[model samples]
Target: METVVDGTGRAGRSGRRWRITSMQVLCALLVLAILGQDLLREAFDAPVLQTAATVFVAICVQALPFLVLGVLLSGAIAAFVPARALRRVLPRRDSAAVGVAGMSGVVLAGCECASVPVARRLIGQGVAPAAALAFLLAAPAVNPIVLVSTAVAFPGEPAMVAARFAGSLATALIMGWLWLRWGKLEWIAERALRRLPDTEGRDRWRVFAETARADLVDAAGFLVLGALVAAVFGVVIPGDWFSSLGEQIVLGILVMAVLAVVLSLCSEADAFVAASLSALPLLPRLVFLVVGPAIDAKLFALQAGTFGRAFALRFAPVTFVVAIGCGVAAGLLFLGGVR
Candidate 1:
C-alpha cells in the first residue's frame, strides 16, 4: 500500500512538471504561422484582411517604443526613488497630493502600459493610492509626448491638444478625489501593497533591470491582444459608420467613446488615429482621445492584474464615465462647441 501511494505521488509530480504553459502554446502557434506563411498571404488577399494586418502592424510598431520607455522609467522610479522621498515631495493632504500627482504627469512622459506597474509600485512604496491612481490616469494622456503627438496629428486644429490635456487632467483629478472619498484600501491586492526590499549600490540597478523586464513581460501580452482587437475592429467597422455619424452628433459621441475602449490605441498614437477619421466632428474625436488612455480593454486588464479585480471593476467604469464628461466639457470650452 505504501509503495502504491509513493508511485501515485511520483506520477502526480511528473504530470505537474509536464503541464503545458501559455508560452509553449504561443511558440507552437508561431511555428505553425511561419510554416503556413504562404496560406496566410493568400488569405490576406481580401481587402478587409489586408487592412486588419496593416493596422495590427502599425499599432504594434507605433506603440512599442513608448511602452519600452515607460517601463524603463517605471523601473527607475521603483529602484531609485525612496518612498520617504516621494512622501516628502507630495503634500501631506491626499486631496492636495492628487492635484500635484495629476500635474506631475506633464513631466513624466509614458504610455498607459507603463503607468499600471508604476502606480502599483508607488502604492507598494507607501504613496497614497489616490495619488498614484491620479498619476496612472494622467501620465499617458497629459504627458508632453502625448500632447506633442496630438499637436502634430492635428496641425490645423491646435485646440485638440489643449482639449485632450485638459480633459485628461480633469479625469485624473476627479478620480483621485473620488477615490480619496470612497475607495477602500482592502480593494487593492495585498501583493500590490507589499513593499520591495530597499537595495543599495549595484543591487539597485539589478532591481531596475528585473522590474523593467517583469513589467514589460506582464504588459506586452495585453498590448498585443489590444492591438489585435483594434485591428479586427478597424476592418469590421464599416467606413459608412464614420460618414453617417457626422450628421448624428449624439450617436457619434457614444460610438466613438465605445470605440476608444475597444480599440485600446496607445495614447501617443491615438491622436493620429482620431485625426484620420475626418468624417467625424471634433467632439467625438476628442472623446476618443480622452477616453482611451483613461480606461480601455488593455488598461482595464492591467489594472485588474495589478490592483485587483475589485478595484478595476469599480475604477474602470467610473473613469470611462468621468472621461466622457470631461472630454465634452473640454471640447466645448476649447473647440467652441465642437466645430
Candidate 2:
C-alpha cells in the first residue's frame, strides 16, 4: 500500500512537470508561428514593414546607450556608496524626495526592465524608499533614448516626442510625490533594504557582475512576459483597429490603457508600437507609451515580485490616471492640431 501511494505521488509530480513543459513549448511554437506569418514577413515586402523595422531598430539603438549607462551607474552606486551616506543625502521627507527623484530619470537612461536592479540598489542603499520608487517609475519613460526614438518614430510630428517626455515627467513627479506622502514604504521593501555592509566599497567589476547577473535573473521573467504579450498583440490585433474606433482622444487613451495592461511592452520599444498606431490620435498613443512602463500586466508581476502584491494594486491605478491626465494636458498644450 505504501509503495502504491509513493507511485501515485511520483505520477502527480510528473504530470505537473509535463504540464509546465507543454505550456512552454506551446508558447514557443506560437511565437514562431506569428513570426512566420505575414505580420512579420510582410515587413520585408511592404513599406509599412519598413517603417516597423525602422522603428524597432531605432528604438533598440537609442535604448542601448541608456541601458548601458544606467547599469554602470547602478554598479558604481552599489560599489562606492554607503547606506549611511545615501540616507544622509536623501531627504527623509517622502514628497520632496519623490518629486526630486522623479526628475532623476533625466540622468539615468534605461528601459523598464533595466531599471529594476538600479531601483533595488537605491532602496538597499537607504536612499529613501520613495525616491527609489520614483526612479523605478520614471527612469524608462523620461530618458533621452526614448525621447529620440519617439521623435524618429513620429517623423514630421515633433510634438509627439515632446508630449511623451513632458507627460511622463509630470506623471512620475506626481506619483513620486504621493508615494512620499502616503506610500507604505516598509511593506514594499524587502529585508535587503535594511542590510548595511560594513565595507563601504566593493570592487567595481564585482559589483557590476553581481548586479547585472542578479537583476537579469530576477527580472528576465517580466521581460519575457512583456515580449510575449507584445508579440501576441502584433499578431492578434489588426494594425488599424484603433483608427477604426474613431478620432476621440479620451476614448483612445482608455482603450490603449487597457491594451497596455495586456501587452506589457518595454517602454523603450513602446513608441514603435505607438507610432504604428496611426489611427489613434498622437496624444492618446503618447499617453499609452508614457503610462505603460509604470503599469503593465507583466510589470505588475515584476513589481509584485520585487516589492509586494499589495503595493502594486494601489500604485497602478493612481499612476495610470495621472499618466493619462498628463498626456491629455500635454496634448492640449502642444498638439491642438492633432484630432
Candidate 3:
C-alpha cells in the first residue's frame, strides 16, 4: 500500500511538470510565429505591416537616449539625495509643498518613465504623497528639455509650446491639490512607503548603478510595448481620417486625448509626433501633450506597480479628466481659440 501511494505521488508531480513544459513550449511557438516576418509578409502581403515595423523601430530609437537619461537621473536621485534633506528644502504645508514640487520639475528633467520610481522614493522618504505626485506629473511635462522640444517641433507657433507647458503645469497643480484634499494613506503600496537604507561613498555609487540598471530594464519593456502599439495604430489609421475630424473640434479633442493615452509616446519625442499630425488643430495636439505625460498605458502600469492598484485606479481617471479640462483652458488662453 505504501509503495502504491509513493508511485501515485511521483506520477502526479511528473504530470504537473509535463504540463508546465508544454505551456512554455506553446508560448514560445506563439512568439516565434508572430516574429516570423518573412512568412507573415508572404501570407498577408501587406505594405502596412512593413511600414508599422519601420515606425516601431524609429520611435524606439528616437526615445532611447531620453529614456537612458531619465533612468540615470532617477538612479542618482535615489542614491545621493537624502529624503530628509529633500523634506527640509520643501515647505511643510501640503499646498506649499505642492507648489514647490510642481516648480521643481523644471530642474529635474526626465521622461515619464523615470518619474514613477523617483516619486515612490520621495513618498518613502517622508514627502507628502500629494507633493510627490505633483512632481511625478510635472517633471516629464514641464521640464526644460520637453519645453524646448515642443518649441522646436511647432516652429512658427510658439503658442503651442506655451499652451503645452501651461496645461501640464495646471494639471499637475490641480492633481496635487485634489490628492491633498481627498487622497487616503492606505492607497499607496506598503513597499513604496518604506524608505531605503542610507548608504555612503562607494555604496552610493553601487546603489546608483544597480537602481539605474533595474529601472532601465523594467521601463524598456513597457516603452517597447508602447512603441509597438503606436506603430500599429499609425499604419492602421487612414491618413484622411485626421483631416475629416478637423472640422469637429470636440471630436478632435476627444480623439487626441485617447490617442495620447494609447500611444504612450515619450514626452521628448511626442512633440514631434504631435507636430506631424498637421491635420488637427493646435488645441487637440496640446491636449495630446498634456495627457500623454500624465496618464498613458505605460505610466498607468508603472504607477500601479509602484503605488497600489487602488491609487492608480482613482488617480489616473481623475488626472485624465483634469488634464483634458486644463488643456482646453490653456489652449483658449494661449492659442487664442486654436486656429
Top-scoring candidate (TM-score)? 1
Worst 10 residues of 2 by lDDT: 10-19
Tell me the whole-model lDDT of each prediction, alpha carbons only.
0.82, 0.67, 0.83
Candidate 2's displacement at residue 146, Å, is 1.5
Report how far residue 109 has shifted in candidate 3, in Å.
2.2
Per-residue lDDT tens digits for candidate 3, residues 1-339, read 122335446522223233456458779999999899779769656778788787778767766776677668768766787556657778999999999999888877767877887788788888999999999999989987788778866889998888888999999999999999999989887888998655554588888898788777765765677677667657777778877787788999999999899878778777766765666888898999999999998899999999889889999999999999999999999999965
How displaced is residue 100 in candidate 3, in Å? 0.3
Instruction: Give the clash total for candidate 1.
Output: 0
- Roughly what TM-score does model 2 have, to 2 decimal places? 0.69
* Candidate 1 structure, TM-score to reference: 0.79
Q: Estimate each model's TM-score.
A: 0.79, 0.69, 0.77
25-126, model 1: which lDDT tens digit per residue?
999999999999999989989998888888778766766766676667667766787545655688988999999989988977666877887787678778
Ranking by lDDT: 3, 1, 2
What CA RMSD would you report for each candidate? 4.0, 6.4, 5.2
lDDT of 1 at 192: 88
Question: What TM-score does candidate 3 reach?
Answer: 0.77
